[model samples]
Target: MSTAIASPRAFKADAAFLRGLGRAFAGALIFALPMLMTMEMWQLGFYMDPLRLALLLALTVPTLVGLSRFGGLRPTARLRDDVADALVVLLVAALAAAVTLYIFGILTPGMSAREIIGKIVLQTVPGSFGAMLARSQLGGEPEGEREKDPPTYWGELFLMGAGALFLSFNMAPTEEMVLIAYKMSAWQSAALALVSLGLMHAFVYTLNFRGGSARPDHIPAWSLFARFTLVGYAIVLGVSLFSLWVFGRTDGDSLKEILSASIVLGFPGAIGAASARLLL
Candidate 1:
């Protein structure tokens, strides 16, 4: 009787885990589907340097840990829980990418081992992000709990960087990013930069959005701009450049060309940075 009861309890726990994993997989697919469909992404995966890919993947560990702290696919109370969740999400992402790519004919047995690993590694970037975001989208933390543990200044900045990276990754591999840059004159690019800054400020400080309200009367406008808006834009720019480099879009590009592309990408990236809190 004891053995039979124990078996049912174990099965129940296993079922719950499977359910959570399924939710995480779905969340990852929602965010990564576009990148998976991009032809440039597929091509770059096979041709990009292995060392660079490894370095980028290594960096994802900390990024995942930070996201897990803020909003993981499941609630975690301990450091070990956070680390375990991150590793599990990464495994799910890799499995999701491999299976989906295989189904789409993007991964085949004929492909060399290096090529296979490269493709999955590149795809895992967005996949892992989606996994981390799963909790936010699929429901894990209560609103009261979230309010009880708000993010720190640096934590907020990390959220901005993650958001910027996601939005920029969606656009960075496209030829249109470069083509739009080519069409813009220097003055237009400058105007764009100003516009990006203005929008980020307005969204996060002045305007009321789903997650943001009008600034408190005590907080000065200049202070808000300096603290959040300026810093967020800087994060956007950094994330934009990093995305371009990761996508192999900056190879052999002139300084002018690179700047233009970064500016164009930075526009959406800034919005992402400003609105990250709302999403997560």
Candidate 2:
């Protein structure tokens, strides 16, 4: 009698794990397809600074762990479970990236191991994020099924940083960032900064976008702005700068050029940060 009951439970657990893996694969592909197909992304995989690439990949572990804590391919009950989920997400991301690159003819047998590994590893960053978010975005679970504990202040900031990084990573490899920066005058760059700030503020506070947070009745408007909006923008700018640097976009560029590029990328980054509650 004991074995009969145990077997069914075991089978159900295995089945659920398999379903989670399937969702992770789909999420990885759906989120990472843009970078997988981008020409600059392919080139950067092998030619960009190896240290930077490795560092980025290393940083991904913590990011995924944090993501698992908040929302992941499955509900995790403990820190150890979250870590395991993060690793599983990474594996799924790597496998998805490898298969997609193979289908695209970018991961040919003729390529050296270093080249093949580089391409897949570079793509896995975004893929992992997608895999982690798959549950929240694709699972379509009712709000009641999700975690009830509200995020703390630092947790909110971290999500904003993650969001900024995700959006910036997609655009950082493209040439348009630098091109637009080159074309714009100093005054235009400043104007764009103001616009980014205003739009970011509006998205979170004024526009009342779905998944946006409401300000506490006791908190003054300026206090909310200073604490959340301004701080979130700062995080977005930092993430944008880091993304640009990771892609070698800032190499040999003047300080002005770097700042201009960062500001340009910060536009999307700001939007991402403001929308983190919705997306992440």
lDDT of 2 at 184: 96
- Show the lowest summed lDDT stretch of 10 residues, model 2: 139-148
lDDT of 2 by residue, 2-62 (tens): 5755697778977888888898898998889999999999999999899999999999999
**Local accuracy of candidate 1 as per-residue lDDT tens digits, 1-280:** 5565569777896687688788789878988999898888888888987877887899888888888898886667887888888888888898889889999999987899888999999888789889888877786557556552767779888988987887887898888898899999999999999999999888887678877746879988898889888988988998888878877788899999998899999999988888887776
Cα lDDT, all candidates: 0.84, 0.90
| TM-score result, candidate 1 | 0.92
Candidates' TM-scores? 0.92, 0.96
Indicate the residue-level lDDT of 93 in model 2: 97
Clashing pairs in 1: none
